[model samples]
Target: MFPQSPSIASASNVDILIVDDEPTNLRVLSTIVRSYGYQVRQAISGIVALRAVQIQPPDLILLDIMMPEMDGYRVCEQLKFNSETKDIPIIFLSSLVSGMDKAKAFQLGGADYITKPFQVEEVLVRIDYQLTLRTLQIQLQQKNNRLREQNERLKQEIEIRQQTEVELRRSEAQLQGRTQQLQQALDELKLAQTQLAQSEKMSSLGQIAAGIAHEINNPIGFIYGNLDYASEYMEALINIINLYNKYYPQPHPEIAKRIQVSELDFVLKDFPKVLKSMLVGAERIRDIVLSMRYFSGYDQAYAQQEDIHIGLDSTLIILQSRIKEQTNRVAIEVKKEYGEIPPVNCYSGRLNQVFMNLLSNAIDAIEEKLEVVEEPFHPIIKICTQLSNSSKQFQDKNTQWVEIRIADNGIGIAPQIQRSIFDPFFTTKPVGKGTGLGLFISYSIIVEQHNGQLQCNSEVGKGTEILIRLPIEVPQSLDVSTTRKVKIAPSSLSLESDIGEM
Candidate 1:
C-alpha cells in the first residue's frame, strides 16, 4: 500500500509519533515525517500510542481516530490526564474525515487535524505547525514562571521599604520632641540670665544713689545749722544797735560818722529779708535730699505700706531739672489730680523707679513733638489717681485697686509700635540713647511685683496715656525670694481707654 522504504534527507531534529491500525498509513506518515527531518515513531493501536508516549514522549503525535483496542479520543484523554505528557501537541490523522470525528479529537486536546489519504505536503506542514506551537508554549510557560518569581521578590522588597519608612517616621517624631524640649530649656535659661543681669544693675544703681545722698546730707546739715546761728547773731547785733539808739537820743560824733558811712537804716531794714531767703534756700535743699533718700531705699525690698503719692512726689522732684523751662522751649506743665486714696502696700523703691521712667518718657515725647509742631504747643503731663470701686465687684471682692493715669500731649506712638513697647530691649530711640528696658522693667514691677495692671492707649499725632492699676494690698501669697520666677504671658499689655485725659 505504501513505500516499504522511503529515502529522504533529514533536515530537522523534531520528534513525531504516528499512530494507526493500518501498516500502510503508519508507514506513509512516518516516511513523510522523516523526509521533513523529524525523528518518527510508530504505534499500531491507541493503547500502543499511549504506551509509547509514556515510555518516550515526542514533540507531537499524529493519531488515527478509528483504532482496534482503544480509540484516538480515549488515548488523547489519557495523554492529557498525564501531567508528564499533557503539554505535548497531538494532531488527528484519520481516514474517517467526518466533522464529528474532528470535533471529538479537538475536544480531547488535539492540536490539529489531517484527513487520511492526505497529501504528503499537507501532513508535513501540519506536523511542523504543531511542533512550532509546542515549542512556543514551552517558552511561554518558562517566561510565566520567571515573572511569578520576580513578582514575589518585588512584593518582599516593597514590604521591607514600608517597614523602614515606619521606623524612620518614629525616629523623626522622637527627635522632634527632644528638639522642642531643648529649645524650651534654652529659652528659660535666657530669660533667667536677663532677669539676673537687670536685678544686679538696679541694685548697683540703688547703692550708688544711697551713697551719694548720704554724702550730700552731711555738708547740707552743717550749712543749715550755720545759717540758723548766723541769723540769730545778726538779730542780736540789730537789737544792740536799737537799744543804743533808744538809750541815747543823740549819737556820739565818731559813732554817728561810722553809722552814717555804713547806712544803718537801710541795713536794718533788709537784714531780716536776707536771713529769711537763706533759710528758705536751705530748707529746699533739705527737701531734695530727703526725696533722694526715699527714692534710693533699695534695702526696702519687702512690701510695706507706703504713701503712693510720696513716691510720685519724690520722682517728680528728682526730675525737676528736666521739667524746668529752657531757653529753647517752654517748661513742661505737670498737672496732678489726686484722689482720696489710702497708702498702698508696695515695694516703694521699685514704684519710685516706675514713676521716674514714666515721667522721663513723657518729657522725651513732648520734647520730640516740639521739633515738628508749628502751632503754639504746651507740653503737658497730667497725673491722676483714683480709688476704683470696680474691683470690688470682681471675683476677689476684698481686693481694692488704685488707678493712676499718666497722660502726655506729645507725638503719639503708632498703633503697630504701641503693642511691643513693653517688650524687653525693644526701643524706638536711636542706639545708645535708649536701652528699651524702661517700660519692660516698669511692667514687671507693676504687674509681676505688685500684681497690678499697666496699659497704654495712644493716637498718632495726638497723645499717649499710660494707666497703672495697683492693688491697695499686695497679695500675701507671692514669694519674696530674689530668685522668684515671674511668668509673663504674651499679649499681657492691654491697650484700652481706662482713664480719660486731663
Candidate 2:
C-alpha cells in the first residue's frame, strides 16, 4: 500500500483525475488525492480519460503509462491538443521506469512524472507548484495591461500640453502686434497735431504781412510819384537862379553883402546834390519795399513757374542787415554758385521760407562759432545750385531735378546730433532764443509738400552742408490751388529779424 498523503483541508476547491487500466492502482491514487481535500475523478483507459476530460476538465491529471489499449502519453497529448483542457497540469504515474519512458511522458506536455510506488507527498508538491505558476502568470498579464493604459493616458496629456503652449504663443504674438499698431497710431497723431499748429502760425503771419503791405503801398506810391516832380521843380528853380546871377554879375553892394553872408555860391552848388541824394534814398526805399513783398511771398497763391534765384536774392536782401558787419565780428560773406536752370513750378512763398530758415540757421551757427574762436575768422556761407541728371542719386528719370547746397563754415553739428536735427522740437539753441520748428518745417515742406529730399552732412570742427533736391516740374496730380496757402506777414517781411531769431 502507498503511504498515506497529508491532509490538505484548505485545497478543497482543487480537482484531480486518476487514470489507469488497473483498478487497484487507480483506487490507491484516488485515496491519496482525496485525502488532500481534492475532488477526484477516475478513468480506466486513455480513451476513457480523454472522454472524461471532454465532459469536465480537472485541475490536475495523474496518468498511468501502461494501459491495455492506449498509453498515458497518447492520453496526455489528446488532452493537451484540446483548447479547453490544454492548461490542465498532467503528472505521469508509470510502472515502466526507463528514462525514455519519462522523457516520452514529458514530451507529451506532462508537468511532472513519478515511478511505481511513488511518494504521495511528491505528487502534492508538483501540483501545488504548477498551480502557483499559472496564478502568477495571470497576475503579470493584468499588470502589463494596466501599464499600457497608463502610458496611453500620459501621451494624450503631453499632446494637450504641447498644443496649449502653441496657442498661448500665438495669442502673445497677436497681442504684441496690436500693441505696436497702437503705438504707431499715437505717434502719428502727435505729429499731425504739431504740424497743424505750425501751419496756423504761418497763416496768421501771412495775413499780417498782407495787411502791412497794403497799408505801406498807398503811401509809397504817392511818395515815389512826387519825388520825380520835386526833382523837376528843383532843376527849374536852379536855372532861374543861374539866369539871375548871370544877369546881375555886378550886383549892388547890399545884394553882394547879403549873398556873401548867406554863402550863396555854396548853397547853389550843394542844393542840386542834396536833391539827387534825396531821390536816390527814395528809390532805395521803394526797392526795399518791393523786395519785402517778394520775400513775404504775398503774391504766391498757386504754383507758378518762377525763378528760384529771384526768391533767393529777395531773401538775401531782407537778411542783409544781419549779414553786415556786427560790432563784435566782421561782415559774413555769402558766395553764390547759381547754375543755369529753368524756372520751377512750386509754391514760391514756401520755397522762400525754406531758404530763409537755412540761411538764418547758417548765420546763427557762424555767430555761435565767433564766440568761441580765438583766431581771425571770416564766416562764410556758400550756396550752390545745379541741375541733377537721372542717376543713382535721383529716383525718377522722367523728371528733372534741381540740387541746392547751402554750406556754412561754422560750429558744425556732431554726428550723434545730426540724425535728430530734423525731428520736431529738436534744437541746440537756448530756450528763449529758438522754437526748434524751423528745420523740421523746412524738411516737411521739401519732402512732404514738394516730394523732394533734404539731407545734411556735417563734421565737428569742419562745417555743415544742407543739400536739397527738388523736382523742377510739379506732378500733374498735385493741385497747388487746393493746397494750404501761406502769405507774407508784416512781421515776417524782415527775414533776418524774424527767422534769425527762430
Candidate 3:
C-alpha cells in the first residue's frame, strides 16, 4: 500500500515519462498522471524515451516492451546503468502480462510492470508505490554515506592517539637519559667534595705536625746533649774508680760509700725518659696520616644496596630544605609505620628522585593549604611501608605484587578530572609551578617499566591515597590487559637482589 501523498506545491513537482508504440496508451497515462498533478512527456518508441531522459530526466517512467528499433527492456537497462538517470523509477506498461515477462522486466531493472489495458486505479497505485520505494532507497544511501564519513574520522582519531603514545615514549627516553647524565655528574661532584674535605682536614694536621716538630725538636736536641754529657761523666767516674781500685783494693768499701752512688743512678733513669718522649712524638705523626687516608676513601661509586628504609631516609634528607615555617617557614613532619618488606630491585638514587618529588608536592600542598596562616599549622607528612597482602587478595595461582601506598592530607582532585591525572601534561598546579609530567613519569615507571599498577582515590577537599602495586619478580614480558590486577606473591618477593649492591 502506498501513502496518500499530500499535494505538492506545483504540478511540475513529479514529472512522468510515458513511452509506447501506440498513441492511445500515451494519451491514457498522460491523463491519469495530470489528474495527480504531475507533468508528462510522451515517447513513440523506447529510443525516443532514452533520448528524452538524456535531454530532460523525469521522476517516473512508464515503459512499453513491444516496440520497434528498441524495446522497453533495453531502454530500462541502459537508463538504470547510467549514473544520472538510474534514480528515475521505470515501470513497464504492456498487454503482454505473462509471469515470465513480468519477472524479466523486473530483472532488467524495471521498478514495476502492469498490463497495457490496465485499470486507472491499479496504474496509479503501482506508480505511487514505485516512487515511494525510490525515495526510501535514496534515504538509505544517504545514511550509509554519513556512516562511512564518521568511521573515517574515528580512524583518524585513533591514529592520532597511537602517534601520541609514540611521542611520549620518545620523551620518556630522553628524560631518562638526562637523569642518568645528571646522576653521573652528581657522583663526580660528591667525589670532589670528599677529596676537598679531606684536604682541608689534612691541612690542619700539617699545621699540627709543623707545631709538634718545632716544640719537640728543641727538647729532643737538649735531651741528646744531656745524654752526651752523662756519658763523659760516666767515663771520668770509671777512670777514677779504676785508679782507686788499683791503689786500694783492700779499702774499696770505704771509697764506694764516699762516692754518691744513688745520685748517679737517678741521672741514668731521667735521661732514658727524655729519649722515650721523643719516640712517642714521632709515632703521633703516623697516626694522623692513617686518619687522613680513611677520610679520603669515602664511598664514591653508587655501590649502595637497595635499602628500602634508607631510600625513605634519603627522601627525607632531600625534602629537609623545602619543609620550613611561615614566610618560607614551612616544615613537613613525617610519620612512619614500617613493616617486614623484602628488599626491592631498584636504583636507590632514582627511587630517591621519585620520593623527593612526592615529598615536595605534599609539602607544597600543605603550605598552600595554610595560605592565610592565622596560626602556624604544623604541616605533617606520613611515610609508611608494610608487607602487602596483594597475593592473598588477588591469587592468580602463580604470582603476587607488593603494594606501597602513599597518602596525603591535602586539597584533593575533582572526580570529573580524576581519570585525566595520569594523562601527560595534565596537572592541577598553577602554570610554571608544575611540569605535569612528575606523576605521569612516576606512573610510567611503576606501570610500564616495572609491570605494576598505580591508582589514586580522592575526593575534593579530602586527601588522596596513591597506591602502587609492583610484581615481586617481573615476568619475562608483560601484557597490560592480562596482568593489570595480578598480585605479587610473598614467595616471589623473596628474590630480592639489591640492584645497587656490589
TM-score of decoy 3: 0.46
Candidate 1, residue 306: lDDT: 89
Stretches > 4 Å off in candidate 1: 1-120, 133-201, 224-237, 298-301, 391-399, 473-501
Runs of candidate 2 exceeding 4 Å displacement: 1-164, 248-285, 295-302, 388-392, 395-399, 415-426, 430-441, 479-502
* lDDT of each candidate versus the true structure: 0.80, 0.77, 0.64
lDDT of 3 at 497: 19
Q: If ranked by lDDT, best first, what sequence of candidates would result? A: 1, 2, 3
lDDT of 2 by residue, 1-502 (tens): 2322333224676677889999988898889878867789999999989988888887678889888788988888888898888878888888788899888888889988888888777877766776565556556767888888898888899989989988999999999999998987776666667666666666666566656767787787787788789878878988987898889888889988998999988988888798788778777777777767776673355677888898888888878999999898899999898998888888878888889889999999989888888887778888888887662454578877887878888888877777678766778999977777788778777776677777776656566778877888775345432323222111101111111111
Per-residue error at 38 for model 2, in Å?
A: 7.7
Q: Tell me the lDDT of model 2 at 144.
A: 88
Q: Is 1 or 2 the stronger prediction by lDDT?
A: 1
Q: Is candidate 1 or candidate 3 better by TM-score?
A: 1
lDDT (0-100) at residue 496 of candidate 2? 11
Tens digits of per-residue lDDT for model 1 on 1-502? 2212111223345667889999988887788778656688899998888889989898778888888779888899999999999988888877787888888888889998888679887776666566656666777787898998899999899999989999999999999989998997776577667766766776777788778889989998998989989888999999998999999859889999988999999999999998888889988988888888888875474788888888899889889999999888999999998999989988888888889889988898888889889997878998889888554323566677898888899888887787688877778888988778788878888888788888777776777888888988896555534443443423323433332344
TM-score of each: 0.71, 0.67, 0.46
lDDT score for residue 185 of model 1: 75
Instruction: Kindly give the stretch of ten consecutive residues in candidate 3 with the minimal lDDT sum.
Output: 493-502
- Candidate 1 colliding pairs, count: 0
Write the residue-wise lDDT of candidate 3 on 302-399 in tens digits.
Answer: 32335466666645643455765446655566666576777765434434445655666666666666664466655566566665545443565464
Give me the candidate number with maximum lDDT: 1
